[model samples]
Target: MLKRIILILLVFSSSMAFSQNGENTWNTLSKVEIEKRFDETLNFEVDYPTFSEEVKKLNGKTIELKGWMIPLEELQGETYFVLSSLPFANCFFCGGAGPETVAEVFSKGKYRFTEKRITVRGKLEINAEDPMKLMYILHDAEIVD
Candidate 1:
C-alpha cells in the first residue's frame, strides 16, 4: 500500500510539472506551406506540405512549442511522445484534426502527461523521410512552465 501511495503522489507531481493553462501557445501550422507535386509516371508523388523558408531556417535551432501532451504508451518515463493541437480524443491521431495538428516530441528527458495544455522547448528537426517518425520533431526538449 505504501508503494502504491508513493507512486500516486509522484504521478500527480509529474503531471503538475507538465500541465499549463491556456496563456501561452505556439502556432506551428503557419510555419509551413503545403504544395502539390504531380508526377504522371508515378501513381504518387510528394504532395505533403513543405516547410516555408523561415521555418526551414529554424531547423537544428532551439525553439519552444506549445501543445497538449500525448503519451505514446501507458508506461511512464517515456523519452519520446506526441504533442497534439487538440486533446487526445480530438487530436490528429484520432482523425479529428489535420496532419499539421500533431508533432513527435523527443525530449531531453522523459515526460509525463496531464489533461492540461503544456509547453516544450527543444531543438527542432524536420524529417521528410522515415514514416516511423513525425515530420515535425522536437529534440532535446524540456518542459518550460
Candidate 2:
C-alpha cells in the first residue's frame, strides 16, 4: 500500500538524518586533529571544531560518565587526570581514540590510574577553548560505586 511505503520512507529518512547530526561526527574528532587547528587565546578568544548542540547543552550540569582513568601528569601525587571512553592504549594521547571521547577529571584525592573502565559522576563542563585544559572537564568528580 502507498501508506505503508510512505511510512517506511519516513522512518528511513529520519534515521538517516540523525546519523549526520554529529553523533558519529563527534566520535571521529581525534585530539591530534583538533589540537592542530583549535586555539585558546589569552584574550579569551577560541576556535573549536564543529560540536554537537547536545554536548554544549550538557555544560554545567551534573553528569555521570563511564570511562577509563588516564594519567596526564608526571607529578608523583597528581590527582588531576583524564577520563576516557577507551583504555590508555586506545585513548586520545595514544592516537587510537578521538577528542570527544576524553574529559579532564579533577578529583579531591589521588585516584589510582586504572586500566579498567570506571564510572565517575560530576559537573560536566565543555571547554571549547582553554589551551591549558582538555575539551571536556568533570569538576568535583568522584568514582561511583
Candidate 3:
C-alpha cells in the first residue's frame, strides 16, 4: 500500500511539472526584428502569400510588442487591445487601422487599463482571423512587465 501511494504521488507531481513547463515553451523575439521585417517587403513568385507566411513564421512564437493599448468597443469583458504603429488618435478610428495598426491581444487575466505604453509578451496566433472586421490578432496572451 505504501509503495502504491508513493507511485501515485510521483505521477501526480510529474504531471503538474509537465503542465507548468509546457506553458513556457514559446520563444520571444526582439522589437527590432519586428520593425525591420515590417519595413521590408519580400518578393515571392509563389502564391504562398505574404501575411500568411509571416504569420506562420511567428506562430507558436512568443514576442514582445510595444504600443499603446487601444480597446475596442465590441470586446468588453474580454481583454482585447490593439498594438498600433503610431499614436492611437493618429492611427486608430480614422479608417487608418491597417495590418500594423491592429493586433488583437487577449491577456491571461484582468488587465489594468492604462494610457501609458507597455510591453506585452505572449504566444502569437496569426491564423485566427476575426470573424467581424479586423487585421492582426493574438490569443492566449499575457502582459510582460
Candidate 4:
C-alpha cells in the first residue's frame, strides 16, 4: 500500500538524519605527533600562544587530550575533577584556582578518584568558561584508558 511505503520512507529518512548528526569527526594524533609539534618548538616565549592556536584550530572537532585529573571539593554526592594540561602544582588554579586552572568534568557514571593522571577523548570545546555552570558544554566526552 502507498501508506506503508510512505511510512517506511519516513523512518528511513529519519534514521539517516540521526546517523549523520551522530557521526564522529574527531581526529586522533599520536604522542609522536604531539611531541614533534610541541616539544622542542614550545618554550617560554611562544608556548602559550602556539598551544592556544592549535587548540583553537581544533574547536568543534574531536581530539584526544591527555592530562591529569585534579579533584575539587564535592557537592552533594557527586565528585568533580579538573583536567589539567600539566601537574597539579603547575595548574592555573594552584595560586588562586582561576578559571583557566581546571576543566569541570562530570563522569558519565559513578566513578572513584584514584590516580591523578588521566587521558580524555572528547569533542574539543573552547571558552567553556565555566563547565559547572553550563549544560552540555562539552559533548561525547569519555575517559581513554
Pick by lDDT: 1 or 4, better one: 1
Specify the poorest-scoring 10-residue window by lDDT in model 1. 16-25
The CA lDDT of each predicted structure is: 0.66, 0.62, 0.50, 0.44
lDDT of 1 at 131: 47
The TM-scores of all predictions, comma-separated, are 0.66, 0.64, 0.53, 0.47
Task: Judging by TM-score, tell me the better candidate of 1 and 4.
Answer: 1
* Candidate 3 lDDT tens digits, 24-138: 1111111112211221234322111135344466666666565666655555446676655445675555545334445678888767666666666666665333334333456
Would you give me the overall lDDT of model 3? Answer: 0.50
**How would you encode candidate 1's per-residue C-alpha lDDT over 46-117 as one tens digit per residue?**
446677776677678777666677755663468778887666787777855666667778777776766677
Assess the local accuracy of residue 3 in candidate 3 as a C-alpha lDDT between 0 and 100: 100
Candidate 3 vs candidate 4: the lDDT winner is 3
Lowest lDDT 10-residue stretch of candidate 3? 24-33
Local error of candidate 2 at 117, Å? 1.6
lDDT of 4 by residue, 31-97 (tens): 1111112334333221121124444655676555455566554632243455654466665567433
Where is the poorest 10-residue window by lDDT in model 2? Answer: 16-25
For candidate 2, report its TM-score.
Answer: 0.64
Model 4 TM = 0.47
Q: In candidate 2, residue 123 scores what lDDT?
A: 77
Candidate 1: Cα lDDT at 144: 85
